[model samples]
Target: MAGSFFRVACQDCENEQVVFGKAASEVNCAVCGTTIARPTGGDAEFTGSVVETVEAR
Candidate 1:
């Protein structure tokens, strides 16, 4: 499956981020150090609000 990018907002700091859909490592918020996404074998499991999806055209 083709991977995409997701625009997410941190739950604690409200910081916006662009994370990999299938991130192989933990993704944290730059502003608050909050755990935003975690590796789940395939795609990254997000713990923040999904602001939008970014796909390559």
Candidate 2:
């Protein structure tokens, strides 16, 4: 709800974070703080035509 970012499923807490940018690539979970999949050139991952948001509140 702040800026354009990427959400990675926390391996523990299952929360999302805005760890993405034009140069920013790798991201850690906002809940668990675990390293998620490194996006290609800060690109967001998608599931077919829908973007996958593997995060939990």
Candidate 3:
């Protein structure tokens, strides 16, 4: 198996992110600088909405 990718969102900042490879202690919101929790995985792919609406990419 490759790995699982997790989609993270900051409720306050409305910043969405994709995290992989290593789990992080604090994920900063690029737009608003809010910290989020990142999970563990690696080499993941993005989808339509997750890339469009959420992730900003």
- Model 1 bad stretches (over 4 Å): none
Question: What is residue 5's positional error in candidate 2, in angstroms?
Answer: 3.6
lDDT of 2 at 17: 50
TM-scores for the candidates: 0.91, 0.37, 0.46
Candidate 1, residues 1-57, lDDT tens digits: the string is: 689999999999899999989999999999989999999999899999989997742
- On residues 15-54, what C-alpha lDDT tens digit does candidate 2 reach at each position? 6454443324555555565666455554544211213433
Cα lDDT of model 1 overall? 0.92
For model 3, residues 14-33, the per-residue Cα lDDT tens digits are: 56776542444445667777
Candidate models: Cα lDDT each: 0.92, 0.45, 0.48
Candidate 3 least-lDDT 10 residues? 48-57
State, as a TM-score between 0 and 1, how close model 3 is to the true structure.
0.46
Please tell me which model should have the higher lDDT, number 2 or number 3: 3
Estimate candidate 1's RMSD in Å: 1.6
| Candidate 1 C-alpha error for residue 24, in Å | 0.2
